[model samples]
Target: MELVCIECGKARRPENLFPMSCECGGLLEVRHDFRRADAEKLRALFDSRLALRTGPYASGVWRYKELIDPEVEEAHIVTRGEGNTGLYDCAPAARYAGVRKVWLKAQGENPSGSFKDNGMTVAVSRGAAAGFRTLACASTGNTASSLAMYAAWAGLRCLVLVPPGGVADGKLAQTIAYGAEVYGIEGGYDIGVRLLNRYGEELGFYVCNSFNPFRIEGQKSIVIEAAHQLGWSLPDWIVLPGGALSNASALGKGLLEMKAIGLIDRVPRIAVVQAEGASPFHRMIASGGGELVPEPEPRTAASAIRIGNPPSWRKAARVLRECNGVTCAVSDGEIMAAKRVIDRSGIGCEPAAAAGLAGLKMLAEGGTIGRDETALVVLTGHLLKDADAIRMPVPGPALEPLAPDELLARLASVR
Candidate 1:
């Protein structure tokens, strides 16, 4: 296995403490050597592990370890029952989006109540195996929670840097509760990440951000597990909300691997949704797919996706083009409306997660997505992650003490 630079195609051994970007200043991705493995035998092995029900096989990510990283020792594997999130059949969400069939992959059901757990489990495990004493990341919210939890499980010191007053209270509470040393930065997530990149080596900390290749490898299991849940059938479309854009790239990578191995015949088109206030990727797509231009001051009510510059833009853009995918930006109002529909269906998620549903509705209305085709929307986080975003109830009658006869009369009149 080797780490390949996405821009210059330079290959380097994965030996450094934190191998984030390439010498060419581009992102790095893990490249594995596969010499035409038997697809049936591989599928049978994965299926057989499901029946064992213990150790690494029970983990949704580790069960596909051969595809993720074949070199990692079994003793170094770290897990917390992550992955295996439910693929829910949501008829109400289908009706709302005007689709014939819809499935909501509830990633919030993971151990940390977000999709970040899928990546953190592998990243931290690799960090531990590399003999790192400390793990760190600059996060908006979810990443902080995940890193802290995984680091705690691995018996490593954890550090998190966040934009002061930028993270949601619930997520901030998770990092603190999980025993991570938190630092407040003057700028946003992108700035914090830059600071970590500059100081991480000197501080002896392994970076656990999306820029890490192992994290991307672990996140690939989300699509892999989703495909397995559907009985190896590929959906017509895979829709997800994009923030740092790592998940989109990982999903595409997983599907392509399966295609190459004859596990699937065709790759599903991907759809990435971004909040209007923080839509650098969507803007890049709108601008004829040229070089990405960062949004200097991204602002959005969805705190989880309020990123100005995504590190995985190049990888994600390539996947989007290869999959013939489309990108769209939705307003906060549209996201909240769609979230209400999801909440009513008893499959609630955070505002950022709801952007997928909102985008699906827009695409369906615009005829970009056919109503007769099957689609899957990925919900990235739990509803309680952003409880403050929940709308308040409408004003009602004032409370007042009254006699029994008067209360009876008022109730009868209202009825």
Candidate 2:
């Protein structure tokens, strides 16, 4: 595998250092030579691994190890059985989105309760293999929880930089509970990301953010595994929330690889949804596509996606262009409405995870996504990851009398 600069096209070997960008300040991507890979054999191998419930083969990300990182040995690999999330066909969600068929892949079902683990497993494993004693990242929540969990298991020091009061309480608790050394940045996730990008190497740590090419490799499994669950059929569209935009970038890479390897016949259109308050990516697309202008002060209740200066925007932009993807921003109210719909369907997700469904509704109304097209919404985080976002009932008496008259009154109001 070689690390190729996305902009300058400069290719180099993967080193032990942590500088993620190219000399021209562009992001890098991992490229593997798969010219000799037998597509039929790979399909059979991936399918056969599904019956294994132990070790690296059991991990959804590693089950396709030939595609993710063939160089990483089994002994150096780190996994918590991540990426085995379920894909659900929810009638209520489909009805709300005005689509004939829709599926919600609950990525929040991962060990860390978010999609980050899918990438973290490969990244941390690579770091460990390279003899890095410490791993670090700047995260709003999910990445911190995932990195901390993996680093702890791998016997490496874990450090996390998070915005002060920016992360959800449940996510914060997970990071701290996992024993990561946490620091608070005053300006929020954007500033923290900037600092980490510039000084992570100087801090003597191995940074494992979406900027890492290996991390993006593991994230490719989200789409690949979805296709496997769909019986190797590509969907008409794949809609997902955009935060760091790494998921979007990874999906594009995964789709291209699958098509190249004869795993699928067509590519799925990607739809990226962002919270209106923190939507630099959507704005970039709205302006007919150009360099990203970072949001100076991104504000959103969906803390997971409250990023003003996303690091992977360039990679994501390339994906959007290649995949014929569309972008839209949704208000917090719309997000909450969609969340309610998902919750009512018994497939609960965090506020940020609902942005896909909300965006799908808008896309359907605007005729961008057809009423009959099949789409899959990727839910990135579990509902409990941001429990504070859930509204509680008004304070009332602890208990009510079990009288027949009271029961009859409640019953009358129910319908």
Candidate 3:
């Protein structure tokens, strides 16, 4: 497999590579050949090995071997078995939205407690194999934690650059646990990403962020797992929240590959759910500019969606346009409401996860999504990873238990 330049579509190897879009400027990305034979064999394999917990199959993601990539050895996949997430056949939610079939891709169940693991597994492994001792990336929350975990397993030094606005405490805890160098940049994730890209080039550090092609290869497995679980039927729509916008592109690649081998007939319409704070991609879709422009002052409680400047905005724009997709921006209050309902459904998705649900609700209410559309909204991360992050109107400290009357008297006095 070879990486392709997004600009020239020129193919190249990934090891110790640099962006050609430099002095001799051009947009580019590492591309992998999607053509593969015996693709239908995976369906038969799943039927035969559905309940086997022996050997590598026990690892949730590893069950689909051909989908994910690992550099050193296939066994050392750097996976906590991140894929094979539970899909809920939600009748109530479906009925509410008036969709034919509504399914939930609960990505919160991943190893890192977030969907970022899908990329980290491949990125960190390839980074280690490429002799990059130190790996770095700019993140909102989940990516930092996910990279930290994988880097620790790969025995590589990890650095996380975060902005003040996002970067949830739970995610930061993982970075600290890996003994990584954490820097809080005063600016947004884009500032950190640009600086890291420059520093990584000069300092010979590995940028294991979404820009790395290996990450997309790893994330593509989500769609693979989804299709297999669905008995090879593709959904009419797959709604997801776009931060840097890598996931949508990766998923499109997966579905397209499956389609090539006759695993499915069509790729689903991709819907990007974004926060009102910063919605440049949404604005692009509306205007059909397909160009990137930075957001001045993004404001929203869905901190993960608060990317003022997305690095992969161009590719993301292309994906939206090509897939006949639409981007919807939801407010913070609506996000919280969606979170509560998602929690009640036993999904336990974090705020970032709820962003998609909020968008689905909005789209349905506005009659943008037809009743005939069968939608699958991805619940992108685990709320348990950041327990209190979503709770609105936070209550005071927990009350202490006191002995019968004495405790009651103290409480009464305080009141």
Candidate 4:
């Protein structure tokens, strides 16, 4: 395995504490020499691990350890049995998206009630192996909660910097409940991230943010496991919300690798969905592509994706280009409408998760995505992760004591 700079093509050995970016100021990606890998044998091996009831192999992220980080020793691996999330085939979701089939990859089902657990396990494990005493990150919510939970389990001090008044109550509570030392920064998520990048080394803490290559490696398992569940069949498209763009970049890397290794015959097209209020990535793509201009004050009710200047934008842009992907921004109203449909289907998700479906609907209507093409939408967080974001129904008149006959009459009058 080698750490390769995405832009300069410079390769280096993986270090105990690798810098966030390459010397060329480009992001580093984990690259493994899989040319000699036996595709069928590895596929059989992965399938065999599904029967194991214990240890790292059981983890969805570690099950593909050879791909994630082959150098990490088994003893150093820290896990909370994360990344066994299920895939749901919902009819209502399909109808709403105007697609023939829709599979919702419920990443929220992970232990942390968000997809971050998948990446956190690998990142924290790497930190523990490197003998780090502390882990830190700037988060809107999900990343903080996942890092804090994993850090507690790994016996490492965790620090989180969140934007003031930006996190949902449930997510904030989860972060605090996991025992992380939390700080509220004056500005937004981008400002908090800049602070971490500038001072993380001086503070003597390992950064667990998505900009860390290991985090993206673990997140790749979302696409890998999804393909496995579909019998190694490639979907027509994989749609996901773009926040820091870590998940989008990881999905592209995983799919391309799978295609390279004959795990799948073709790479699926990717669609990145962003909330209109926080749509820097979408705007960049829509404007014929250039250097990403960060949003100064990203506004969105989807707190999880309320990031403006995502550090991983370059990586994600490359992925979009390679996979023939498209990007779109959806209004908050559209996001909520799509969320209601998924919620009514009994597969509820947070607002950010619904952005993918909303974008898919738009694409379908715009004639970009065909109605017959199969697509998979990844829901990054559980419904309760941001319970406060959900609007409550208006209360009806208070009920009075009623006789059995009166109740029967009322029931008969109901639909």
TM-score per candidate, in order?
A: 0.95, 0.96, 0.89, 0.96
Model 3 lDDT per residue over 134-158, tens place: 8899888888888888888777788
Best TM-score among the predictions, by candidate number: 4
TM for candidate 3 is 0.89
Q: lDDT for model 2, on a 0 to 1 scale?
A: 0.92
Q: Write the per-residue lDDT of candidate 1 for residues 1-415, one digit (tens) a residue.
A: 8888998999888765444787678889988876667889988988998886679779999989988877789899889979989999899999999999889999999998999998888888888899998999999999999999998888889999999988999999999999999999887899888887777877888999888999999998998999888888977999999899989989989888888887777999999999999999999998886788889989888888899899888899999888999999999999999899898899899999999999999999999999997899999999999999997665445355778999999889999
> Candidate 2: where are CA atoms >4 Å away?
393-415
Model 4 Cα shift for residue 283 (angstroms): 0.6
Candidate 2 structure quality by residue, lDDT tens digits, 166-218: 99999999999999999998887777777777888887788898888999999
Off-target runs (Cα >4 Å) in candidate 3 are: 20-27, 34-36, 45-62, 70-72, 392-415
The full ranking of all candidates by lDDT, starting with the best, is: 2, 4, 1, 3
**Best candidate according to lDDT:** 2
Error of 4 at 145 (Å): 0.4
Query: Of the candidates numbered 1 and 2, which has the greater TM-score value?
Result: 2
lDDT of each: 0.90, 0.92, 0.75, 0.90
On the 0 to 100 scale, the lDDT of residue 3 in model 1 is 88
Candidate 4 structure quality by residue, lDDT tens digits, 1-415: 8888999998888773566777778888888888987789889989999998899899988998887888999999999888889999888988998989999999999999999988889889988998999999999999999999998998889999998888999999998998999999888778877777767878888998887888999999999999989999967999999999999999999999988988899999999999999999999999986889989889888889999999899999999999999999999999999999988888899999999999999999999999999899999999999888787664444266678998889879885
